[model samples]
Target: MQLPMKTNRITITKITADDLEAYEKLISFPQIAEGAGFNLISNKQMLGELAKRQIANDNTFGIRVHDQLVGAILLYEQIGQCGFPDEANLEISYFLDPELWNQGLMTEALEKLVEVFKQTSEVRTFNAEVFVDNVSSKALLGQVGFQQVSTVIDPLVGRKKLIYKLEL
Candidate 1:
């Protein structure tokens, strides 16, 4: 709900064009791109454009450690997905630095994000979807109190997808 939301190790802050280089590098990792269900972009111009869009979105946040950008999270509306479109519902998507996986940083960052929203916003639920084989994401969602709500084939990628929801 607020920029620069801090916890013990990580701080959640608004992503800016100044962070473009780091954000691009973070999403450039093949493992992170695949897990986040996006193709790794090879065109510099397109990648920069995409990163700029992310920076411009108010709902997109960078997860930082000691002032260095390590990851990013986005909460937005996806009209036809997990829940009805409204202020009370939003879809969440995130990616972490692959080198930092399994360190529980994402868990802590996500928990703080949810806590802030629960305390400061009118949002009542958060929705998410991950590829069925993305074990870490599923685990992170579960650790943050999200429950599996459905499984369906991802129309864009043809992979089996697991949908999750957390009601607050």
Candidate 2:
């Protein structure tokens, strides 16, 4: 589904294969990669492979501003091979160009996502994991009505992440 532009200058749309380059750059940033609790992409080949997999997923979306790819948001439908709440319980992950930090763009995009999710019958709640040190993301999630559930030590990144949940 095509989400309405939160700002007149920006458009939020579903992810496509053409977004590979932008996605690579967004995830390649050291800060972004570290904060996301993931290893940095070292080459275009790795990025290509990653993008291919992401594109095949039905839960990813791209966020663009003025026709330029700026970031992405992901909703995880399952954990490993186990089923959960179908689409009723969704986990959200997102990242923006560091240059766009503090501009309220992420908040705007998140608000738009919430608006769209509200219209879907299967989505009853939204969940997010914010790095304990990511103050900006915490604030944005709070602004969007997410309440802190708990903090968990992420073995993958060796950092504690605060889990937040929003009931729709």
Candidate 3:
């Protein structure tokens, strides 16, 4: 909702092409990609295009610490995924640098973003889908007050998808 939101330990800003080089460092890790449920991108050109598309959409935010991009949080309208077909609902997705895992940075960032969204938007519900094996993400959503509502097999990936919801 707002640009450059500040949290207790990190700053959230719109992801820009300028941050792509540093953002690449976070996405380059196979573990991060796997945990975030996205395919790894090795080509800088494709990453550049993704940066442009993300910037134009204005839904993805960069998680920065002392001016360096270390991770990202994406909040966007949810449709036809996690059994949420309504456009009023939003899906929360994120990935953080592996080196910063278990440090509580993502929790803080996610909490602040949701708080801001609650204040700025009319939306009352947020949704998140995580693979059943991603314990950390499931824990993160629970910590932020999201309750798991359902579980379904992902036909594309053939994995159990846990659907989480947070109602503001």
Top lDDT prediction, candidate number: 1
**Model 1: residues with Cα > 4 Å off, grouped in runs:** 40-42, 80-85
lDDT of each candidate versus the true structure: 0.88, 0.81, 0.83
- lDDT by residue (1-168, candidate 3, tens digit) is 668899878999988778767776676688876666445565668866776676556788999999989998877886756776565677878888888999999999989988887899887888898999888899999999999999999876688899999998
- The total of clashing pairs for model 3 equals 0
Clashing pairs in 1: none
**RMSD in angstroms, candidate 1?**
2.2
Please give the lDDT score at residue 25 for candidate 2: 76
Once fitted onto the true fold, the runs of candidate 3 whose alpha carbons sit more than 4 angstroms away are 40-48, 80-87
The TM-score, computed over Cα atoms with residue i paired to residue i, of candidate 3 is 0.87
lDDT (Cα, tens digit) per residue for candidate 1, span 73-109: 9988766465565767889999989889999999999
Encode model 2's per-residue lDDT on 1-168: one tens digit a residue. 555446655678877878777887788888887876446555668766877787668788788987888988888864434644466688899999999999988888888888877875468888899888889999999999999999999877678899999998
| Ranking of predictions according to TM-score | 1, 2, 3
lDDT of 1 at 132: 84
lDDT of 3: 0.83
